[model samples]
Target: MPAPVSTASALPARALLACSRAYCAAAPRSSDICSSLEEQWAKIVLVIKYLGSKRTLVPLLTKLVEASGASTGLDLFTGTTRVAQAMKTLGMHVTSLDSASYSKVFGDTWIALDGETANHSELVDAISHLNSLTPAAGYFTQSFCIDSRYFQPFNGERVDVVREKIASDYSGTWLEAPLLASLILAADRVDSTTGVQMAYLKNWSHRSKHKLELNDPVLLAGQGLAVQGDAL
Candidate 1:
């Protein structure tokens, strides 16, 4: 005869029901389903465009960590921080390190965030205002895109505007990192590169012609650390 199942393991259904009730009780009240859906979507992972970004491997890697019974993870060479962000989403305490300043911006914004520090409405308003601003040629346009074809002039100008605004107005604030990350991701989306930004297409890709837009950076509520420097 098979051995009887232990009560501790067999009570998972009861435990899950209890957990669901607790979550429902703690959840904030929202007037509309659309607002609630938007709030939930904002907490989802931000899709990053990067050469050699390991976003597709996150699920498998996360499973391995869980199987190992590891509670903490350290990500070295955390470019774009997709893996670190994924691990954090799976409830691990993650420490992410990258040498690139741009990667550090991603790490600080997504991995290090512990709950919502900035007001959502205010952030949305700020993004809307930035997106509506008229585009103009600037350093980015001259250096990377319009002058060199790394990106189209329209998108390049938008990148310059958003970057300048974030640097001048939002720097050193809680809003800075996420806002900057959003801008970088936005630019990446419209870039006319096959993968890396080392070169651009002979002509503009359909994506490059689209107006640049910013989306909210995925913010995790779990504790994390972002380090910028050589991992060695």
Candidate 2:
């Protein structure tokens, strides 16, 4: 009867080395892992702010995908679609799923949009105009920031104006996703939260005090699926 090998330290030196080598061999090579990480990081750099975003896990997830040699992927709880966007950037067909309307907009804009129909320069100009529009105290200002302080009242007013403009002018158009995503990202940039909307900081963050500005979303070129439904 052999003594029970209850711990890894009980293994013979040669057995330990062999196990280590086998583990390394089964894992993705260092270079492949690095490249995958870089690729995934690059994709999510453009994603809009969302609660529980998995942007930080992109590198680890990418390495796992490379090790598995998966050709396609699905992000079942694709909040803001950061992971799905990364998979699409890796040339894997991706399907993004989220129950929230805002997340669906992110997916449609960043992953599923057909950009050829709209002129890029025109969209940029439109965003620039929205950024320059004067802020006014409105619903968002009164509702979220003036009393609640979720954002500086000035920025919140600007958010309201831009949102109303988009709703009136770009509603149901191909430009809607890109334009709306731009606003959402801009608003997130100026929000006074510590990364979520459940509470606001007692004082405004410096970033929140700056004038709000919108940047064009980096739309990917490809056909993908954006589904909004319960994951369960």
Best by TM-score: 1
RMSD of each: 16.2, 15.4
Worst 10 residues of 1 by lDDT: 41-50
> Model 1, 108-141: lDDT tens per residue?
8878877545477777788888888888879999
lDDT of 2 by residue, 1-232 (tens): 0111222322454354455445556775765655554444422221222345576788999888878888888999898788888888777778899999998999888778755555799889889888888887888999899779888888888998999989998899788888998998788777775423336767555567678889987778666888999988
Model 1 TM-score? 0.74
Q: What is the C-alpha lDDT of each candidate?
A: 0.72, 0.74
Clash count for each candidate, listed in order shown: 0, 0
Would you give me the overall lDDT of model 2? 0.74
Model 2 misses residue 15 by how many Å?
A: 47
Highest-scoring model, lDDT: 2
What is the lDDT, from 0 to 100, of the residue 79 in candidate 2? 80
The true-versus-predicted C-alpha distance at residue 6 of model 2, in Å, is 36
